[model samples]
Every structure is written in C-alpha cells, then in structure tokens.
Target chain A: MTEADEENGPDSGHDEIRSLVKGAFRGQQEDRVDVLAGVQAKIYDRSGGKFFSDGWSTSRTPPISTYLVTSWVMLLILAALYCVLAPISGEPKRVPTYPAPVRVIPATQ
Target chain B: MMRGLSVTVTEADDERRFLRRLQARDEHAFNELVQLYEGRVYRLVLRILGKPDEAEDMAQDVFVAVFRSVDKFRGDSKLSTWIYKIAINLCKNRGRYWSRRPSEAAEDLGDVEEKGWLEEGPARTTAELSAPDQHVQGYQVEEIVRRCIQELGPDYRDVVVLRDVEELRYEEIVEITGLPEGTVKSRLHRGRALLKARVSRLLGEKIE
Candidate 1:
C-alpha cells in the first residue's frame, strides 16, 4: 500500500473515490445528459430501435401496429370464449327467421 | 488432465447459460453483469482515456457490444473473464483512436474552461491556501488522493486503481488487462510507490 493508503485505510480511499465518482456522475447528469440522450436517440433512429431493443429494451414497449393486432386477436378470442362458456339465460331454442306462414290472409282471399 | 478439461467445460457452460439468458433479453441478468463489473470497466476506461464522458460512453458501448454479439459468446471461460477481455480490446481500440485524434486535446481544454475549473498554478503557494481549521485538512487529504492518482503513469495508475481503489482480484485483473501476473504485480508496486511519493509531496513530507 502507498503511504497515503497506509495513512488512510482502504475504506477511506474508497469513500474518497466514491465521492469523486458521484461528483462526476452529478456533473454528467446536470450538464451532459441531454446531449448524451440526443446522441443515443440518433443511434436509435439509425438502428430502428433503442439500444438493447430486444425484450430488455424499455420498461414498457411502445404501442405499435403489431401490439394492436395482437390485442384485437386476443380480445376476439376472449369474447368468443366468453360467449360460448357463459351460462344461457333460457333454454336453447331457435328463433323462427320467417313468421309462421300467413295462411289466414289466403283463407280470407 | 481430466480435471482441467472439466474445468474448461464448466466455465464454458456458465458462459453459455449467461448468453442464453441474454439472448432471451434478460434485463436482470444484464444488470447483474453490469453491477458485477461496471466499476472496473469505468475505472479502466477513465484512467486510459483521462476523460469521464468518453469513459461513460465506452462503458455503455462495451455492454451494447455484449448485447449485440451475445449469440457468438463461445463461453470458453468465465463470463466475467470473457467480458473483461472484450472490454480491454475495446479500450485498446479507443486508445488507438484517441492517439490519432488531433482535436481531442483542444476539446478537453475547452471542456475544462466551460466548467470553470482552475488548475493549480505554480505561482500559488500551498501554504497560502491551507486553512487554520483542522476539518479542512481532512477534505484536503481527499483532494490529495485524487491529484496523486491523476499524476501516475496510465499503466501504473490503471493497475493501482483496479487493485487498490476498486479491489479487484489479481486473476480478474489479469483477465481484464491481458498482462502477465508478474507485470501486474510490478506495476502495482511501482504505482503504489509513485502514489506514495506524490501524496507525501502533497503532505509536504521530506524524502529523508
């Protein structure tokens, strides 16, 4: 260990370094992050997605056409399933599409 | 021989598993790896480049590269070890690019000026700045440490920071630096001595 290190334990050394690093980070955050973000944004534009664009890219994936399509498909399937599995209100009976023939009209004629 | 082969296989398996998780885009695993080594990578880049912004960019770049090429990870050794190797190579490339950069020094000078940072001028006497209060002296010690580190040769500085400041194990240092063990040890020793002298100078200790 250096004489300075001997005077100060490794922990102190670490503390000092950590403070400097924190200061650096603070400086970066305050002054440079916008520029950095812009650069990263440009990179994203060029690459067609953000860095780490796979599943890990963003906290939440942005809404896209595919997302809407998937949601619609899922909703349709779910609605169909609900219709099929839900309890019926009454006994199942086919409603007549055409009225029982109006033979009364023919008898009057 | 069989044990050695098995060891290699085990290392490879671990790497393969990590890469597989990465391929599945595992953020937790990625963050785990970053948490494991970001300090070492940051210190390495900072010491090598002598610029914080560049170091941050490089650090991010290293991970981005890892993410891009995760599929190609052969997993012959430990994951950390392999990542360090790639980081060092990237640092070297960055170093080479920097050495060829004609405008970087001027740009850095501008950066310092814009930040209103003042360098220690030779005309200013240290005694004039020393305060009567003892608490200030403690703060001065930390500044001394920073300046002492800034003065060491890059090779020595890097190893010193990696070993003493970052506290990385010798084997990891070797894997990251691609230096032989003896070279690493020698660099650390020399670095410590140089650092000691500089700090002693800061403290006004006589060389006796």
Candidate 2:
C-alpha cells in the first residue's frame, strides 16, 4: 500500500497509526490516583450539598412516586375548586334587560 | 442476533440499576464508577489535552459532571457513551481556552510538522527519536504524532482522537459528539488525512 493511503482513510487497516498512537502515550503518568474523594468533595461543596448530600437531597432525580403524588394532589385541589366555585361562577352574570332597542330602516341598499 | 439482543437488554438493565444507585448518591456505587471508567477517561483526556496533569484534572471534572448531571441522562444511550460525551465536552472547553492563549497550546509541546504526504517510504526523523524514551523509536514517533494531533484544530482534533486514538466506532463517535453520522465520517476522513500528512512531514525530517 502507498504511504499516503496508510493513514489517509478513517478505517484504513494500517498498523503504523495504530502503533504510533499507542506509543504517543508511553511513559505518561497514569491516572491511578483515587479522585473519588475529590469528585465527591466537589459535588458536595460546589452545589452546597444539593448533590451527594447523603440525605433526602442526595438524589439528583426525585423518584417517580414523587411526581405521581404531586399530580394526584394537584388534581384533588382542582376538583375541590371546581365543586366550590362552579355554582357561583357561570356565564359571567347575565345582565337583566329586555331585547335590543329596535332601530328604523336605515339601510342604504 | 438473538443473543446479542439479550445481552444488550441485560446490559441496559444493569446500567439502569447502577444509574439508580449513582443518582441516589450511593457512595459505593459512585466509587465503583470511578474505578471502572477512570482509566479510559484519563487516557482520553490525556490524548486530547496532551498533558498528564491536565488529563487528571479533566478526568476528575468529567466524573464530577457525570455525578452532577445523572438525572439528565435519559438512558437514550449507554452510560459509558454519556460519560465519554461529558469528557469530550470538558476537553473541548479547555481546548478552546488553550486556543485563546495559543502560546500554551500544542505549539508549546514541540515543533508541529507541516503537512506532507508522499507515496515513498518515510524516513525515521529526529521527531521519532526525541521522545522521553529514546530507546523506543515508536515512542518517539508516538510523541510527535501526539503533538501533531494536539496541533490540529479542535473540530478535527476531537474526531481524530476519538477515531484513531480511542479507536471508537463512528456510531459511538456520533452519539458522543452529537454530530450526524455523515458529518462524523467526513470529519474522520478529513482528520485522518490531516494526521497522516502531519506525521508524514515529521517522519520525513532528519534526526538533528
């Protein structure tokens, strides 16, 4: 294969690049340090215990049960509101008056 | 095919359980997560950033990001893919900052070779003999290529690193980068070409 075609393609079956890429990272300091503490500390400190709080607020996503309960509560409130206000609020209080005052023929037909 | 499907389902279920624990702030689960992906995360950032110290910091930030945004992940993709996405975004953000201060960018690493691709065999250049380990010629070439990859623009750099260095598939790259499959392929093609040309030039230089 031509040298140009070696690393020219995305999936080119050339070992040069595969090996060279591997070699590039040789002798680099490995990331073996346990940063779990740092990560946890950052999460706790940055958000002021909003996350990783080890308590009620620990969950980044509240459970689905929370949503269901909230919806049910809201529906109950709406139902109670409708029952209490339905009779008092309807058709916006019709004004007691007779029919419109009839006007004589003013058509310019 | 049936087996693969079953395996995928099992994997998904396992991830869901793990994600639950993580989202719930299970310290043990989170610690397990660090143990699981920290090496890959560190290596990826090291390839992208070209510095071990920076990679360490970036990897920590990546995990922190994953922890902070676990709820945002909708299980539309694999957890590892999501983590890769976060790591890449952090890398790009830091890359942009470095680009703003060009002096501290890849040029600071070493002489980035110009684009040169030839049909002939490449000569082993000084760039290939200047790595930390002079005993291994591959390491020297590796160092030069690493620097060249860093020298590439962020758009091309991420694609090249993902495809070539990380050896990720195009589909995973699309999911991680949020680019169209065609865009990812085209960028990979272009990125690989750039990398080849750069390596060609560096490998052609005489040992000084």
Candidate 3:
C-alpha cells in the first residue's frame, strides 16, 4: 500500500458506517426505468415530429436545404416583383432632350 | 504510448458518436444514456432529498431536461459529469423548497427502533454474531447512519455523499458542485470527521 493509503487506512467505525449506508440503499428501483421512457415520450411529443430533424442537430443551425430553398424562393419573388413593376420595353422611348443652354459670353481678347 | 493515444482517440470518437445519436433523437441512444445514469442520479437525489418519491420525480426531471437540451451539450465535460450537475442542482432546489416550508422538512425517525449505539452493553461483536443477527444489527446501524446523514447540513451532506458514498474523485466533485478544489477537500474532510465522531459516539467505539 502507498504511504497515503496507510495514512488514510480504513477504520472499523468508518467501514461499519460505510457498509451500513451501502446496504441501506442497495437495489436499483425498477420504476426509474419507466420514468426514463415516460420522459423520452414527453420530449418527443413536445418536439412535434421535429426531434429527428436537422433543427435538433448539435449545431442547431438551419439545414443547407432550408437555406437553399429560401434563397431560391427569394430570388423568384424578386424576379416576379421586377416583372410586375417594370414597364414592358417594346421600343426605346423617344428622346426628349432639349438643346444645351448656349452660354455665349463676350469673348475677352 | 501509441496504445494510450489510440484509446484516447477511440473514446473521443465514441463520445462524438453518442452525442450525434442523442442529438438525432435516437431512441436507443436515449435509452442507453438513461439506463447508464438513472440509478446514479436517483441515488444521489435520494441522498440529498431523503424522500424516495421526490427523488424519483427529480431523477425523471433531470433526464427530461437532458433530453430537451441535448442539442446544447457541447462535449466540454464528460456526459456523466453534466448529468451529475443537473442532479445536484435539482436536489439543491428541492432542498431549498423544503426549507422554505418548514412543515415539509419534518421526518419520522420513529419507524426505526431507537437503540442507542453508545449504550453500554455486553452485546456480541459483529464477527461473533450469527448471519441473521448480523443482518438485523446491520439494518439497525444503517438506520442510525441514515438519520445522522440526514441531520448534516446540505453543504456538508452533499460533499460527503459525493465523496464517501458515490466515490467520485475530488476533481469530479469540484466539477459537479462548482466549488474550488480546496473547498471540496475541506468540506469532505470536515464531513468525514463529523460522521466519524458521530458514528463513533453512537457505536461506542473509537474511529481512529
């Protein structure tokens, strides 16, 4: 035995008490297993069929598919908005440009 | 050295797999975790609360919390250590709740016969006793020890239970309790000394 072990060797009194404590609570209760199942079921129900989904992943970030779908949908929406708001360009509109203002000042020789 | 490194790598890989399975809400993985930890959690809570029903409920609550927050576990510590922290926190909360309502803290010790361990007697030593007599004697001593443990303050009792009963390492105790290592050692020493003295007096025997 190590020196430390010898120094803190078991005492009869302590051993007796320790044994008593162990004996008092020896067996594992069976109901705790049932409790575990019940809690798992509760968690499953609360998660609402999303327990196995990517939302519950360790990183808990949105899935790539979600981001991809969202980006595509946004692009489609923006294209639709542009189509609705922008005027149909059949031909170039007539230029209504006026002549540049003639600023003819006296030439200083 | 290579073998040790391999063992470490294997353990890390296993832990990673377990965490992935848990986060994926694998029923088998959840069941395996529960089976591994439920007894220890229940026993720890029972030691703290001293009520079987409450301990059972708290044990369930601990696992439920773990299940709900499995995605948040970052694998910084052993899973058992995290579970122990949850159990300890729940026990502390329940103890505080009971303390707030003094009426609920009253326990009946009368169910066990009050045979003073310190009483002067020519009783047979445990070694000399028959098997049945030894069993009875052990039961009586256990009852006394349980009462003594219940009488200890929550701080002392928690340290004592984690150290003596659960047989956790000092570092693990520190992690679970969030106490400094020095404080954990001191509490454990004081708690053991106190139990030794009390049990010695009760048994009419020297502890050291």
Top candidate (TM-score): 2
Can you tell me which runs of candidate 1 are displaced by over 4 Å? A1-56, A60-109, B1-16, B23-40, B43-51, B102-135, B206-208
List the candidates ranked by lDDT, beginning with the highest.
Answer: 2, 3, 1
Alpha-carbon deviation at B111 in model 2, angstroms: 5.1
Relative to the true structure, candidate 3 reaches a TM of 0.66
lDDT of 3 by residue, B1-208 (tens): 9999999999989989999999987766877788788877887888777778888888888988898788999988888988998888878887788778857555444433354433443223343346885656655655556667777777888887887778788779899999997677666666666776665566666655
Worst 10 residues of 3 chain A by lDDT: A53-62
Show pairs that collide, candidate 3.
none
TM of chain B, each: 0.62, 0.83, 0.83
Chain A TM-score by candidate, in order: 0.27, 0.37, 0.34
Candidates 1 and 3 compared: the better one by TM-score is: 3
Error of 1 at B30 (Å): 4.1
Ranking by TM-score: 2, 3, 1
By DockQ, the best candidate is 2
Off by over 4 Å in 2: A1-9, A13-15, A26-31, A50-109, B1-4, B106-136, B205-208
Model 2 chain B scores worst on lDDT over the 10 consecutive residues at: B110-119
i-RMS, every candidate? Answer: 8.7, 6.0, 6.4
